[model samples]
Target: MGQGEPGDLTGRAFPLGDWGRPAERLDELYRWVERGALETAAWYLADRTGKRRGARVLRGGAAAGAVAGAALPLLDMTGVVGGVAPWGYLALLLGVACVAADRYFGVTSGWMRDVATAQAVQRRLQVLQFDWASESVREVLGPAEGTAGEAAERCLLVLRRFSEDVTELVRAETADWMVEFRTGSAPLGIQAGGVAGGRAAEGAVVPGRLGVPPGGTRPNMPRQRPPEAR
Candidate 1:
């Protein structure tokens, strides 16, 4: 881990400094991709889990509210609980409000999109690793039409390009998430034309809901073409 050293990545030592030594750089590049992909997966998994729970809570609250409202009128009409219908209606309103808030704030949609993105990224990493292994074998067994170093350089180019693509995609996702946090809107997967005219774009992030922001609240980045699968 010293400066200029790729360090003991796994069991192999990646040589640093030597453009003539693209094999080591290629290995290091793969390592970077693996590390970034794993980190990305973990972070989004946490996010997905948290938001999923929030979504369940919201759905339950809404259902409960609806039941209370419907049964209150019947209970009051039956005279078993006279004059309780108003309270029942109020409770229902509260429940509906909670659900509405959840939808508008994009709690459910955010989790789904992020989880999907995480899975996709993880799959890409797996493919990249597989390809790297295949290329390594090829380099070993294939005729030396090009020098080993030349082959390594080609591998570096491919790996670096793929790595950049992944990084940009993840970064774009984060930027969108930040905007959602600030603006309190979901990514259209949650609320698509059923209620509020498909515009659930208002709310503040509660503390401990996502992560604690600096000032404790904001609901909610940019558009980017999704990366192509390699």
Candidate 2:
């Protein structure tokens, strides 16, 4: 990867570009899509695995806290455990905190969402491979029955369409995630709604958040309609 190459953004499903000839560029475009999709799947799979473990830990912590909180006071009331009853309320509070943290951090839901998105992208990758194959077999060659330029044009068009689809797949997932974070229903990232309206609209990226200066993360491109599936 040279300076300003698209592959520089590791683990990102973003587009790629190269300074090669048209044939080389076309080959590279396909490779980039394949690589990006595979990496996206791998990243999400790893992410979901970690989050699944976190979800289990949170559930266990909450359950243990609740059991201790209840049994400690019971044992004290029965005179089986002498002065330990006073700590029961603290245990109950710990349980409540655990539950709150689970929701706030989206341990379970995030893992589920990651799995879904990863599988979706993987399926799309298969579809793209077959779609390109379908396009390659068509008799759309130039008047010479198989001109190099016309064949390359067709291949480029097919690759471009597939690339756009990949981008849309990622963008849709991102939009869903942003909406969840901002909406009050998730009990997660509620401040995002307020922050987006108040701070972000003023062209100021929150410090230590996103780490990208205003307009540097991605071009503020218009919403694109899904490309026709060919």
Candidate 3:
């Protein structure tokens, strides 16, 4: 879409002069996601058609060759003694060849599946990044006065959540649990956890923290309150 008006949702403009580096980094991440998706789809298609077709052809050829070889033995084994025996030998050879070919080609399916899954994970991460970028832009345009600190806070919150979601997505896809989140690439060095104690007090809500107005709570949502006396 056209980067709409400066403050328009469609435009979602950031201070290009300041956010240029981070913006570029974000774009790079998006590209990676898109590429990964394409690669995954390719792997899937090859696994489904190319690999299976190759295996089928190889198996059929091996079977035919085996039957021919076995026929000669069978003839020799009959009164010629070479007939039936040769046929049996040929059949055994063909069976082994077919099995071996299938085993070799079968590997492609698993490998492609793994590659597809990895790409899917990357795509999920990209989606999270896109959402974070959009949300950050909207927050900046909210009623709250946009300042460096406010922008930073908004960025930090979004980054923190995005990182967590990505980490979880990776773990889910790979079945290996690990939590690793980086913030260097994020705008304003916004990380999941709060800033260091020495740098700023914990939970210190800066004025810039107020980006968008807090939307009205849902009517059915339960409001968390302090525990009452027993």
Q: Estimate each model's TM-score.
A: 0.67, 0.58, 0.35
Total backbone clashes of candidate 3, pairs 3 or more residues apart or in separate chains: 17
Q: List the lowest-lDDT window of 10 residues for candidate 1.
A: 205-214
Positional deviation of residue 68's Cα in model 3 after best superposition, in angstroms = 9.7
User: How does residue 29 of candidate 2 score in lDDT?
Assistant: 70
Ranking by TM-score: 1, 2, 3
* Candidate 2 C-alpha lDDT tens digits along 1-230: 01242333334343466645665666677787677667656655766777899889888889988998999999999999888787887888898888888777777766665566566556666777887776555533324466767777877766555445444444443444554555512322111111111112221111111111111112246989999999
Compose the digit string of candidate 3's lDDT tens values, residues 1-230: 01122321221122233355654554554444444334433433443455456656766767776776666666675666533675667666877777665554343333333343334434544655677667557655763666655655565555445333333322232221011111111011112222111121122111111010011111245879999999
lDDT of 2: 0.56
Candidates 2 and 3 compared by lDDT, better number: 2
lDDT of 1 by residue, 1-230 (tens): 01122211212123356666666666766776577556556656766777888888998889899999899988999999899999899989989897888867777767765666566556656667777888888887994587776777677765655554444444444445555665667543221111211112122111112111011112333568999999
List the RMSD of every prediction in angstroms.
12.5, 11.6, 17.9
Give per-residue lDDT, candidate 1, residue 128: 71
**TM-score of model number 2:** 0.58
Please report the candidate that would top lDDT against the real structure. Answer: 1
> Residue 204 of model 2: what lDDT?
16
Error of 3 at 100 (Å): 2.1
How should the candidates be ordered by lDDT, best one leading?
1, 2, 3
Candidate 1 colliding pairs, count? 10
